[model samples]
Target: MVAAVTGLGLGLAALGPGLAPGFVLSYDMVFVPDPAFTRMTFGLTGVVPRHVPSDAFVTALAAVIPADVVQKLVLLAVFVMACTSAASLVPSRRLLPRLATGVCYAWNPFVAERLLLGQWALLLGYAALPWVVAAAPRAHEPGGTRRLARALLPAAIGGFAALTVSALTAVTVALATRGERRPRVVRVVVTAGVLSLPWLVPGLLRPAGVPGDGTAVGLFAARADTPFGTLGSLLALGGVWNGETVPRSYGAPVTATIWLLVVVVALAAYWRWGQERRGAVIAAMVGFVVASLGAVSPGGLEAVIDLWPGFAVLRDGQQYVAPLAVVVAVGLGLAADRAAEARWPGVAAAAMAVPVFLLPTLAWGAAGDLRAVQYPDDWARARHIIDGDPAQGDVLVLPWASYRSYSWNHGRRVLDPLPRYLHRRVIVDDAVTVDGTTVAPEDPRAVRLAPAARTGAPPAVTLRDEGVRYVVVDAEPGTIRPSGAATAVLRGADLVVYRIDGAAEATGDQVPVAPVAAAWAVASLFVFWSFVAPRTTLSIPLLGSIKPRDPHRRRTP
Candidate 1:
């Protein structure tokens, strides 16, 4: 429990301002006030289901609690679970080593970078890696499927990205510890596949056939975040592709060099004291290789995507470094044990503090980049307007851009949240421009409408053809061409809404919710049964084993 407290402390430090009641909006981390379910929430769209179950999961929680609170709770749970879970794997029985492991895992550069990038959903998987690793060998045991499913619950909520990472960790551990061709591997695969149906089915069923944009591989592949280059940055667990997401002052030669040295020392410690755990050693090697593959993506990646679109998940290879985090955390704890054994308890304590010291900027909510803020009143007004309308036509968000630096969000760049906040389908730009190269979007609507939204005029006629009845213009206003004097009669523009002549009912492909719902039901049964089921025996050392009393014997006192 000391380790758990330490973990909570690290979380409180990292989330200082973010612990406030408002939504902490930045990059991909978007939380609406009161999210409601929609077809889009179920990944029922023309594109791959990236947020599939994660959005749906959050919406369910929001039905009981405010979404912002749910966001904070989930974020806090990430740290608490990460810290405690990492500590659980240390070979040493000493408290110092456990504390060291908890701190090292909870406050590293990877967590900082991913948090700053606002991929909280991905972090949910990252945080749960230790638990998945612990559950790997036991997966071969009886009832292991249920146990594995419970360990994977957080990743299940995180959808595709998280589940993929967890799969790598679980399968690698199972293979390394227990030889392949075993039932454990089959059980692991089946469990992951069942939970994955929510997103998997939609991606397969997507009219675009999994929505692959080949250029994304080159655009999102890992890059150097330190003077030591891509390999060094990756070794130190900080090679996220987006340079802006690196923590403040982290790339300085001195700091980056210190971090690299720290990684080297941790690896040495693992080699000396913890390497015999074949699972950790093999998982680390596998993770590093996968990450390096993305850093130096071969020409075949795009071709591979041509053959199979799901392979596109490999584009963001840096996320695969998650397993390496587990190896390093346990290694650092082992190093602490060695230090204390050498009669240098202070050094052991110093090891516990080293991660936070090296990544100092993670404190106070990534140095205030993660502060909470209120959405504009106009946004609420717009939602109310959209929800009040009985007429059915898709809501199109304008500006032909994705991220916005809104004054209300303290000038932070966030993916437009209108689609998640509103009750009906709302389309926003999906194309992302990085380094003067625009990665094409996977959304069919974006492909079909972007051109007309950019260059077409006579707003009503342009939208009427596509069945768009209302348009939302946020921050970047006036992107839409005003209706000419001749066409003004059919167009109306208010605060953020552009009303036009309604067209035919919104027409497009949508994923069937039945399969995904049934998948969740199946996974939930395993998860629930994992907690409640037993052959029925409770034993205490001082007493004989006891069987569960039948309700018919309820009068027993």
Candidate 2:
């Protein structure tokens, strides 16, 4: 209970006034007022299932409650789940050290950077990682896969990106643990593979898996944030790919030095006095090496991606540092426990406060970078008209790219919300440009339309020929309106919606049914069996036949 409240407090402090009713449309995070579940939501767009189950989950959940509210709940719940879950791993009887672990785990640079970048889905997998790692070793035992499924439910909702990190953690831990390696390794693969089917089935069914420019390897590599350089920043859990996502005033010499010292001390303490550190330490080291690969040797990563596009997952290397964050979180709790053993209560209290003190910018909405803003009323009007239409055709959002710096959204550069907001096949740019160099595009349609967007819109005859039923000009005032053949459907202060006359009806690509359905069926059965099976969260029959006792009990408290 205390851990949950501490998490809520940290969330309230970090998100600050931004938690007020409006949506926080920042970078990759896009939550609409009311999102319609299109064929694309279930991976029918056929390019990649990057959003997959996450988008589907949101659409269904929003059917009962508002999406804006759902977004807020998810963001807050991330902190709560992370805190309670990490606290459960501390193996301490006292509340102080466990609370220390929870706070350190919940309020760190990784969480702050990812939050500011608006990758809340990825953070969901990250929050559940502690349980995933802990429960993995027991997966070979009876009813073990069911429990593992429960641990992975959030990661499954997070789609491809989340599962990538989760798989890395589970596999490395399985390899490192002392036991019959084959069974543990097999369970890890089988369990994670089943939950991953929603995205995996689409990716494999497609001729190519994940498309993008090879240049993304260089663009998304971990970079130096502190004076200690990339290695130092990563060790401190602060080197995310995007600079804007890094918290304000972080990496300053004094702050970086103090934080680095704390990190070294905590890590050393864990090394000196610990059991079960072998698997976590190996996982963290492996994660650090993976995170550093692109930055240190981009050529190797480029070579790998050239061989197979699926390896492009390694491009945004900094996210792989998730296991390192878990290591540091657990290390902090171990250090605090050691301090209390030495009768230095002050040391333990200071350890609890250290994470908060080092990264003050994380509080109060990352110094106002995370403030929420209401969407213009014109957006809702546009959705209404589009939904009213019976014709099936694509909706093209113009200025023809993803990530809008809208005045209405307070100049926050957020992904264009049209794709998820509208009911039709919505086309917006999926290609990402970092520091002004265009990375290769994932969608061929977006690439084809890039030239059209660069100049004015394609001619209305061409638009009709291409099956564009609606072209939405969502530009701000003072932007030039290109002459085009489409009729103006609606003109509001916020946007101008143009209708392409006589456009042919368009149908979305067919997503494969059998494999995806089978995967979903297996995952559902696992979850259902998990519920029907007796709930056994304590130490199970695996891990040396010793029943794991609750960590809350202590010899001296």
Candidate 2, 1-557: lDDT as tens digits: 99999999998898886798898888989988788877778776666778878998888889999888888888888999899888888888978888888888898888999999999999999999988878777776665666777888898899888988988898898888887677777777777887888888877775444565566798899988889999889998888889988899999999899988887876886677657756877888999999999989999989888888888888888888888888788888888988898898887788789899999999998888888788888888988898899886788777866788988878888988888888888777787888997786666556666677666556666656667788887876225343566678788887888887677755434567787777677666765666776665423234334333344777575
lDDT of 1 by residue, 254-275 (tens): 8788877877888888888875
What ranges in model 2 sit over 4 Å off?
207-209, 477-482, 507-510, 534-557
**Using TM-score as the measure, which candidate wins?**
2
Q: Name the regions of candidate 1 deviating beyond 4 angstroms.
A: 179-181, 456-458, 478-495, 536-557
Give each model a TM-score.
0.92, 0.93
lDDT of each: 0.79, 0.81
Alpha carbon deviation, residue 549, candidate 2 (Å): 21
lDDT of 1 at 386: 77
- Please give the distance, in angstroms, between residue 4's alpha carbon in candidate 1 and its true position after superposition: 2.0
Give candidates' CA RMSD values in order.
6.7, 5.1
Residue 189's C-alpha lDDT in candidate 2?
79
How many pairs collide in each candidate, listed in order? 0, 1
lDDT of 1: 0.79
